[model samples]
Target chain A: MEQRRKERIDRGVKVRSDSIYALMSWRELSYLTVPRLLLIIGMLILPLVVTSMYWQRVISIVCIYALLALSFDFLAHYTGLVSLGGAFFIGVGGYLTAIFNTTFGLPPLVSIPLATVFGAIICTVLLLPCLPLRGVYFAIVTLMYPLVFARIIEAMDILGGTDGIMGIDSFSNRWIEQYLVIIVVLLLLFGLRRLVNLDLGLIFRAVKDNDQAVRASGMSITNYKALAVLIASGMGCLGGACIVHIYMWTGLSLFALDFSILPIAATVIGGAGTLVGPVLGCLILVPISELLREFGTLRIVFYSIILVGFIVFRSEGIMVYGQRKYHQFERWIKV
Target chain B: MNKEPILQVRDVTKAFGGILALNRVSFDLYEGDILGIIGPNGSGKTTLVNSITGFIKLTSGKVMFRGKDITGRPAHKIADMGITRTFQIMRPYYSMLAYKNLVIPLFSPRAKRTGGWRGGGKLGDRDTVSIDILEEIGFERDSYVPYKLASTLPTGYLKRLELARCLALKPEMILCDEVFSGLSMSEIASMIPLIERLQMSGITLIMIEHRLRELFKVANRVMVLNFGEKLIEGLPEEVIADARVKEAYFGSEEAKEVMDHA
Candidate 1:
């Protein structure tokens, strides 16, 4: 009897590129660089390439969602903290940047950074109590934070309340705004890529694998978790700050669940662990969202269909699927 | 060997709502002794390991490690004090390579301070040290077995990886929760020498095992637990001879038949 089985093997170039031998050949080097280059170059030119003024604005919006998705992916996949606080972080950063620009008279440039840093610190401090809570508990607390902030703002009738903080500054020009966000996203995407390979990243991953075993290894899981939250929240807040400036306003809407929900959807469609996947997902999803605007409320139905289709069909996500195709080839071989 | 016991458990009790998972269990483990704990399913064997290693809180009890009361201390604190454990359901870092799994424990403060696995007062080159530990625990270095992902490894290798992780900490005492449960006869045969070698290195071990034949070979003393209570504690032969332990393990009818044959 004859039997055969399908086997998957890494491409010769991929194998070579995985090692020091990659430097010896331009083919191997290019194999390593091309996908990354495509991402960077593709993102860099997207603002100029999109001719429509409305769609250009959508690019900036996509970048903002990408940042949120990146943060969500990092915390959920790497740190095992399934956080739904994207809205909470965005709300904090948006409001803080608004106050800095509107009340303190800080420039858009200065306020964004200030809001990002302080908002992150605030988010981390607030989330500290819930750091010990694992899995869904951490998620529920995070989900509640934005709602609580929203209600508090609505109830207290403070910080412009329902009307929101208006007359806030936009970036000096469209180019600066577009490039600023796109560059920041690229830098963070690459920076985080490096970070997850570092010793601290090792600790984060270990904490995720089994906190009990990590504890058994004598490292405090709580400390590593706090550090991961700080990093993730910082990224989300940066996005929030940028969005506030882009919109020229900050308000209760900053705490909207769209910020929370969309990034997670982006993460799922793009791939959960791969930081770039979520960004790619936002690029695909946000534009489709904008395009679907003509359908009015029915856009949500189209949105759900697309999401459900992706979940059911290509659930491993586009990046993972793409990576596998790029790196390995499969063929039937005799057993 | 009249030295003071290194680990002392006094009247340890754990309850889940109205049910007592562990009822007033107390035992002393001395330096360089292999203590085997045997029981049938849900006999509180694993629960005892959990309580001592600080994996769970004790309802009312004292766990003293070398005269220091370590009761209710966090698991990390207990591990830092040189008491490490391996899970019965091996919890290897699935995404990491086999050697990388040990690197985490090797990076621990305790490993750095105490020096890991014959580290000779210097914890040097963690990657190399981790590979060395993996090789020592039967991972074939030449074949790149240590370089393979932990998730891909078979049960035999995963079991060894579990022990390798504990050794990376240079632990004074290791609470092994069923290290032999899933292994074959030849694998357990090979594991016996590794157990003896670990003992020879002066590290104490508390093994919870169902394989009584293999366990009796290594354990200096045996304790039997029945329904969350200590049924008996004695030498392996003495424990085997006890009618109560047989009944607890094999049930009354089967135990009587075995006893009658004996």
Candidate 2:
């Protein structure tokens, strides 16, 4: 009797280029850099290639969602914190930036950075008490924040109230608006990629694995959790700040659950921990969402079907699957 | 044998609601002896370890290490004081490489302060030190076993990795919770020498095991617990010969049959 099995092994180029010193030839170097270059080049030319003004706006939206997705993935995968406060971060940054630009008379450039920093600090401080909670408890607390903030704004009739803040300044020009977000997305995507590989990143992952074991190693889990939340919230707030300027309006819609949810969906579709996967997921998903707008209310049905199909078939995500294919080759062998 | 006890437990008790998981358990462990705790399932063996290591708060009791009262301290603080423990159901960082698993503890403040295993007054490169510790505990340094993910390692290696992690902390007293469970007979045979070597290195051990034959080979002292109460404590042979232990382990009818045959 003969038996056969399929085996997966790393490609010769992947193996040779595993270390920096072995990347002597251009082939191996390209094998390592080509995927990254494709992402960078592809993103850089997106505005030029889209041509449609409406679709160019969608690209900016994609970048905003990409930032949120990056935050969601980092907290969930690296720190074991499942945050559903994307809307909360967005609303805080959006409102703060709007107030700065409209009432405080600051420009978009000055206000966005200020709002991002201050918004993140506020989110982190509010979330500090919940840092000790893990899993669903932590998630539930985060989910409540946006809902609460939305209602408070509606009731108080402050920060533009129900009508929201209108007359907010747009970027100096269209190109600046598009490129600013795209570049920040690229920077954060790579910066986070580097962060998760550092010694601090090792500690963050250890906290995710087993907090008790991490505690047994004599490090404070709460401090690590708080730090992770601060970083994630900063990214989310930056997205919020950008989206406000793009719309030239800040209102209850800034705290919409869509902001919270779409990024999570994008993360699932892209891949959880790869850092770049969520951005790629945003690239794929945000455009599909726009294209489906023609179907009106029925868009949700098609959108859900696509999500379910991805979940059932390629749940490890596009980036994970693609990376596996890029690095390894499979063949049938007889035993 | 006359050395002062390094760890002292006096009336350590834990209560979960109305049930008494551990009821006033007390024992003294000397500096360099291997003490074996044996019991039927659900007899508070793990609870005892948890209570001592500060994983769970004690309802009422005292734990003294070197004459310092350490009752109800946090798990990490207890571990930093050189009392590390391995879980019953192996909880290695599954996402990390086997050697990288050791690297985490090697980066601990305690590891840095104690200079790690044979660290000789300075904790040098953690990655290299991690591989060295893995090699000492049977992870082949030259092979991919050390480089393989913790999730991919077999139970035998995972168990060794558990011990390897504790060693990376340079622990003084290690409470092992069923390290031999789920291991093959050959694996257990290989593990006996490693346990012996660990004991030879002057680290005290308290092993919780169900494999009585293998456990009796190494343990100088044995304690039996039945239904959260200590049945008896003595030399392994004496504890094995006791009527109460036999009755608790095998039931009265089986005990009679075995005793008559004996």
Candidate 3:
């Protein structure tokens, strides 16, 4: 009887798994259909249409900012941990790469990844102590990271004190830098989606939904939360490394609350947990923010209003709302 | 049919600061038997389940599972060792669909690591088991609507979803805390057949419920508790006839009427 029970259970698991695989295969095939293929092909060739250097510069800045927002969304939506120190890892990456390129005589290529890794490791370890905390307590503790980092950098003579690290080398070719930024943004988009779709990602979501349920299933809640923070910091650090290379300097100004809030705002505005939310948020907010930069002192105010508007109206953000709208349109067309 | 007990609890006690939740509780679960525990509100039935599942630290005594002392093993680790449980308040992931809730257990680290997937005979192929269990519980195989979002589900569906997820683990023993509470008569009746099927599948179950009629019908043996101590453990008919059991039930006039009718 026991043997028969085991055999029946095994067969049940196999059939369900086969069905899930079939669903994924169907999704993949549909994604590659004629109109979808054309749309994807058009998107891939968009940059070639623009000949102006001015457009290139604007696009690069937008990509970098979007990267920052995407990382924040990964933490907030995927793991259900609201961390306010979004810029801390970015600041570390930028500052470290700048310092390495200028003082240590390193190429931008070598310095960027190294700086990102260094920043990621530091933040990952530092965030470990706060893993046991939850809710606003976790958020408040992490919020102090950027503030404390800024104070320490300012007080230290080696980091040029309050003046910050500066005069780092820009990319040798401007076009190369622009393409590099776009590529990084695309990679982050792909990576974020892949992470959310993985078994580990599902575990993180399970933790978010019900920590006690996750624990009873024989998984460590603390470990999973810590891992989420680590991955978020890693993405932030990578974006920061690229931004430093594009702008050629890093300062305490880059690590401010505005930088931190930008990602949170973008993530919220775009849609928190959905695959395309942060990227869409960045696509919309980054261009507007870049345009409003001409307004000087009023730029932050304008961004804040936009963010508040997003929060007040579409609380789930752009992607979620857009997805529903898209579905409605499809249904209407079908009818 | 006599066999050695698979689980033995010796003088187990738990206290929250100064208040005693369980006092010198001792019981045994047989290798392959359905045990029913019935009690009034706050009689420490759930507390006993919690202690066995390692959700709470015991103030005194030890619990041995499969002859190995497993006192204070932590909830997840205890679950890892082939003992799974459900809450009095159901805990299905609200954002996930009904089927996806079952997937969590099927992919549970303990279940997966124990050879539940390839059937190295470690955890014992939980994924395939879960799908079959879902079918047995009367969940439609082709219907994807039920797997959409748990938060949108009716109360009856939620209870079944919780049970389906627990069954996904293919546990050696299942500790169900008040599985029938808050469920409608129809809902309770539907679950009876599923419970019967699970028994037929050779899974040992320990259910705590307030529904005495269902308990009496389903359980081969019944245990009653009052004020954190075991009042009686015997065949349901014998326990119902006990004077102590009737006295405990007499605390409520409605229960007295029900007892007289019985």
Question: Order of all candidates by DockQ, from best down to worst?
Answer: 1, 2, 3
Query: Per-residue error at B32 for model 3, in Å?
Result: 1.2
- Of the native A-B interface contacts, what share survives in model 3? 0.62
Give me the displacement of residue A145 in model 3, in angstroms: 1.5
> What are the per-model DockQ values?
0.65, 0.51, 0.45
How well is each residue in A185-220 modelled by candidate 3, as lDDT tens digits?
Answer: 777777778878766777788888998887777667
Best by lDDT: 1
Model 3 collision count? 7
Please give, for residues B73-191, the per-residue lDDT of candidate 3 as tens digits: 88888888878788888888898766666666667776676544223446533334555556656777668645568898777777777676666565778888888889888888888
Two-way DockQ contest, 1 vs 3, winner:
1
At residue A323, candidate 2 shows an lDDT of 95
Q: List the residue pairs that clash in candidate 3.
A: A9-B128, A9-B129, A12-B128, A13-B127, A13-B128, B114-B123, B116-B125
RMSD of each: 2.8, 3.2, 8.3
Q: Candidate 1: list runs displaced more than 4 Å.
A: A1-7, A50-53, A132-137, A330-335, B241-262
Candidate 2: docking tier? medium
Task: Summing lDDT over every window of 10 consecutive residues in candidate 3 chain A, give the lowest-scoring window.
Answer: A1-10
Candidate that would win on TM-score: 1
Minimum summed lDDT over a 10-residue window in model 3 chain B is located at B117-126
